[model samples]
Target: MPAPHSRSASTSVLASGSQVQPIQTPNVPLDRSLLLMSLAEEFFDAAHSIAPSVTLSRTGENVEVYEKLISTGLACLDTALSHVRLAPRVEANIRLRYAGVLYEETENFMEAEIALSKGIALCDRNHYYDLKYAMQLLLAQFMFKKSPKASLKALDSYISNAEAYQHISWVYALRFERAAHSLESSSLTDYHAALQNLRSIAKLAGEQNDRPIYMMASLMEAMAHLKSTGPESMEHAQRAIAAVWAYQLDSDNRIPQLLGLAHILDVACSLRQGNPTVMINKLKLMQTMMDEALRDPTWSTTSNVIAIPINRAQNSSQVVSPDTRTVLGIGNDGRDNLMLSFVSKKDAFSITYLLCGMVFLHRNSTSDQKGFKYLETGLNSLEADMRAPRASSGVLPDCIATLQWRGQIMCYLNCYMAFCAAAITDWATAKGHIEKVETTARDFDVPLVGPLGSVLVYLTGVYYQGIGDLDTALEIFQGKTFELPAETGKTNMMNSADQVERDIALLAALNSLWILQDGDRKNPSRNTTLIARLEPLCKSHPNKDIETAFNLVMATVETHPAAALFQVKNCLRAALNGAQTTANTQFLCITLSVMCNRFFSNVVGAQAEKSAQAASVQAQKSGNILWRSVADGMLAQCYEVNGKAADAKFTRDHAFKLAQMALPDI
Candidate 1:
C-alpha cells in the first residue's frame, strides 16, 4: 500500500445543514507550495507501490489484477508529472516511468522511445547521475533493434555512469546484458570475453543475493559452453543446470520459460555428447514444464501482445517539443514478463516436439513409424505459427525481433525434419519438407550463406540425392553463392566460417562420389577441387571419423580400387564400433555401396569370395536392410562372374525380395 497524503487542499466537506464550504490554503506562499508538494508526494508514493503490486499479482497468477495495477500506476505517474512544482529529478523519473509503462502495457514502442529519450535528455541536463544511469540501463532493451554497435555504446555509457554513481548492482546488470549480446558474435575473442563477463556477473549477483540474475547468467554461460565442441562442455552444462534447479527449488512459481531454456541447452549439450537417452528425458521434462506454465487451450484466439487502446498522448496529432514530457510509469514486474512472452508457448512446444522426434528417429530407427507423428505435429505447429500474423508481422521492434527469431527456428525445424525423414527413407515426405524449407527461406528472406543456411542447403541437396534427382542435387552442390535477406542479412554470429565450409566440403565430395559412380569422369576439375578440400580436412578436422569418411570417398574416386577397398573397411569399422548412430549413419550407406563395388571388382580371386561374404555379413549386422539388399545383389554378380549360375540366380531372387522390404511405407 502507498503512504497516504493529507488531501486537505483537494478535498471539501459538506455541513449537516447541506451548505458546503470550500477548503482554503493559508495566504503565505510557503504554505501554498507545501500543500502542492504534498499532492505530488502522494502521486510519487502511488507510483512506488505499482511495481510491487504488479509483481505480487503476476506471481499469484492474478493477471487481470496485474494488468489493472500497471494501468493505474501509469495513471498515477502521469498525474504526478503534470504538476508544475514537481522536482526535476522526480519529473525525469516520471517520464522514464511512462516510457516503460507504455512499452509494457500497450506495446506502444514509439511512445515509449519518445518518453525514454526525453527522460535521458532531462537527466543529462540536470546532472541526476543516479536517475540517468537507471534510465540508460533500461534503454538497452529498446536499443537491441536499432544496432548492436549502438546498443553496446549505450551500455558502456551506462556502466560508466553507474560506476560514477557508485551503483555496483546496476553495473552488474549492464554487464550481464553485454555478455548476452556478446555470445551472439562469431569472434573467438568476443566469445571468450562474454564467458568472462558472465562469470563476473554470476559472482557479483551471488554476492548481491540476486538469485534470478545469477540463474540467468548461469544459463547464458551454459549456452556459450554448449556452442563449444570442447571436452568440458558437458561439465559446464551440468553446472548450469544445477544452478537453475537450485533457484527453481527455492522460488515459488518461478518462470517456467527460464527453466525451459536451460533444459533446451541441456538437450543440445546431451546431443553433442551423443547421449540420446538423456536428451529425450530432458526434452520431455521441458515439454511438461512449458505446457503447464504457458499452454492455452484456445491458442488460436490469443494474441501474443496486449490489445490496449492508444492513450491520449499517442492519439495526439500535434508535433511536440523534445522537452515535452508525458506522464507514464510501468511496474518493473512486466519487463521479465515481456521478455519471456517474446518466446511464444507454441514455439517452445514445437521445438520440444521436434527434438523428441529427432532423438527417437536417430537412436531407434524402428520407432520412426511412431516418431513421424511427433515430427508432423511439430512441423504443423511451426507452419501455423509462421503463418500467424502476430508472429510474422508486428507493429513493434520486439515483435519484429520475435518474428525473426521464430523464422530462424522454423528453418531449422524444417531442415532437421527433412534430414530425419530422408534417414528413415521417407523420400516423398522428406522432399516435401525440403521444399518448404526452401520456400520459407525465400518467403522470409532468410540468409542462405550462414551456418543455418548451409545446413538447409546441405539437407536440400541430400534430399534431392535421396529422391534420385541427381542433376538437381549436383547443380545445388556446384553453386557456392548464397543469398541473405537484404535487411536482416547481418553477418550470422551463429554460423561460423569453419562450420559452413565443412558442410560445403562434405556435400561437394558426396556430389563428386555420385558423379564418379555414374561414370562421369570427364569433370576432373571438380574432383580436383574436392580432393584439395578433403585432404587437409582428413588430417586435421576435430571429428576425425567424419573426416575419414570424406577421405574414403576421395580415395575411392581418385586412388586404386584396392586402396578404396581398404578405406571402405576402415569406415565400416568406425561406423560399427566407434561412432554415434547420428554420425555413423551419414556415411554408413555410402561406405557399404562402395564396399559392394569393391567386392564385385575382385571376383576373379580368393579375395572375391571373402570380400563378397564380408559385405553381406557386415550389412546385415548394421541392421540396414537396404544395404543388405545391395550386398546380396553384388554377391550375385560375384557368383555369376565365378560361373556359379545356380547360386547367382538364388542370390538375385533374395536381393529383389530384400529391396522390396526395404522401401519405406510412405
Candidate 2:
C-alpha cells in the first residue's frame, strides 16, 4: 500500500468578532451620544461573552445568539459614529471592534474589510499609530486564506508601519505572519528563509521574556522540520516533541487550541519515528486530552486564533453536501451503524483516528477490521463537520477552506478503504471506494498530482488485477493507460514526492513483470530484459519491502533447479526480514507460497507440506481471500503427496469454497 504523506496548507487566521458596518455622517440629538455608545459596548460585551460557544457550536443556535448581539452592537456603534463628537481614536477603536465582530461572528468579510479600512484612516488622521498597525495586522490575517499574495503584501506594509512606530511586538507579529506565508510557497529558498525568520523570532522573543511568542515560534520551527525529509528528519521530529513537551509543562498559561495542536504535532512526530505501538498509545492519550478539554467550559471562551496546518485540495469550486448516505452507504441503516458509532467531535483530535487507522494498515496485522473502524469514524466526523451550517457555499473563504481540508482527508480515507476491501477480495466494495475517491477529487477539484495520483493509479491496477483483467492491470501498472503526467526532470533524491513516485512506479513494474512472466512462459528473453531494467531502479529506490518483492521475482526466473531452490530460500529470508522490519504480511505470504511450490516441484513432500502450512497460517492472518485460497490449495496438494487422503479431500473442498468466495465467476 502507498503511504500517505502529510502536507501543510496555507495559514489561515480565524476571525475575531470585533468588526462592524461603515458609519455614515448624519444628524442626531446631542443627548443620544453617550447612551448609544453605552448600548454598543453592552452588545459587544454580550457577543464577546458567547463567541467561544459560536466557535464550537454544532448547531446554529449559538451562532444565532452571537450574530444577534454583534448585529445590535454594530447598529448602536454606527448611530454613535454618525453624529457624536467622539475623539478620533475612540471612534477608530469602535470601528475596529465592529469590524472584528462582522468578520468573525457574522462572516461578513466585505463589511468587515470596509470598516477596518475606515478605522485605519481614522487612526492615521489622529496619529493613533498602535491602533492603525493593529487593524492592519487584522486585515492581513483576514486575507490569508482568501488571497495569500495579498495577505503577504499587507503583512509587508504593516511590518514597515510597526517598525516606523518602534512597536517591537507588532513588528514581530507582522514578521511571523510573513514567514508563515513564505512557508506556503513550494520553494526551497522560501522554506529556508521562513525557518530563519522563525529562529530569529524565537531568539528575540526569549531574550525579551515573551514566552508565548517564543513558544509559538518554536512550534512553527518544529513544524517546518517535520515537513522536511532527510537524515536530519528524525532529529527534527525529536526536537518537535521536546518543544511540545515544554509547551505542555506551562500549567499557569494553557491555551486549549494551541495545546491541542501541539499534542497533534507530538503524535505526528511519534508516527514519523516508525514506532506503531508508541504512536497508537500517544494517539489514545491525545484523545483523552481532547475529551477533557471539551468538557471544560473555559476551553470555549478563549479568543485566541487557531490556524490549522492541514493541506487543502486545490481548486474547490463549490461546497460538497454533507449528506454522504448516497455516496458512502452510511446512514440510519443498521448495517453501518456500528461503524458510525465511532464517530466523535469533528476537531483537531479527530485526525488522530485517521492516523491510527493508517498505522494499523501499515503494520502486519491478521485482520484489517480495526483499521477499517478507525477510518470509518474519521470519515464520518469529517462529513459531520462538512454538514455544519457554516460550511455553505456563500461563506467563501471558510467554505472553500473547509472543503479543501476535509476533501483531502476524505480522499485518503477512501483510498485506504479500497485497499482494505481489495485485501479481502471484496471487489464490489473496493471498486465503490475507488470510485468515491475519484469523484471526491473531481468534486473538490483536487489536482491528481504527485503521490496522490500515484496511489490512485496503483489502486486502479489492483482493482483490475483482482477482477482477472490482467491485460488492463498490466497497462495501468506500466503507466501506459493512466492520464496522469509522467515523472519529469531530475528527481530530488531526498524529496518524499519523488520517493513515492518511484515506489509506485516500481510496484507497478513488479506487477507488470509478474503478469508477463506468467503469461509468456516461452519468451524467456523478455523476462530477462525487464529484470535488467528493474534491477538498477530497485537499487536506486532502496525500499525494504520493494527490495524483498524484487528478490522474490528474481527467484522465479532461475532456470537451474538447485539455483532456483537456493534463490527461493534466500528470498524467503529477505521476506521474513521485511516482515519483521516493515510488517508487510502480503510479502511474507507470497514468498512462503513460492517456496512451497518450489519444494513440491522438486518432489520434497515433507518440506512442501511444511512451507504450505506456514503460508496458509500467514494468509489467514492477512485476511486476504486470494492468498488464503492459494495457500490452502497448495496445502491440500501437499496432503495428497503425504498419502493423507481424507485430509486432502477436506482441505481441497475448503480451498475450493474460498476460491469461489474470492472469485464467484471462477
Best by lDDT: 2
lDDT of 1 by residue, 1-666 (tens): 211211221122112112312343355344333343344344333333343333322333333433444455465566666654667766775676677656544666666777778887887788664456556755776676566777777787776766565455445556867777777776767788788888887786677565666777788888787665555656876787788888786653355556677777777666655555676677677667766666544232233531111112221222111222221122233211112132455666767776777666555443334456677787788777555443132223343345556567677677767766665556677778778877777665566666776777777777666655678877776666332122322323433354455545555655646565565554555656646555654543444445545555554655432344566566555543433444344345546556558545645766786677777765664555576788888888888888889998999999888787666341
TM-scores for every candidate against the unseen true structure: 0.66, 0.71
- Each model's C-alpha lDDT? 0.58, 0.65
Runs in model 2 lying further than 4 Å from the true structure? 1-126, 135-168, 208-212, 270-273, 298-304, 307-345, 364-368, 385-395, 441-450, 480-502, 521-537, 540-544, 557-571, 599-602
What is residue 235's positional error in candidate 2, in angstroms? 2.4
Worst 10 residues of 1 by lDDT: 5-14
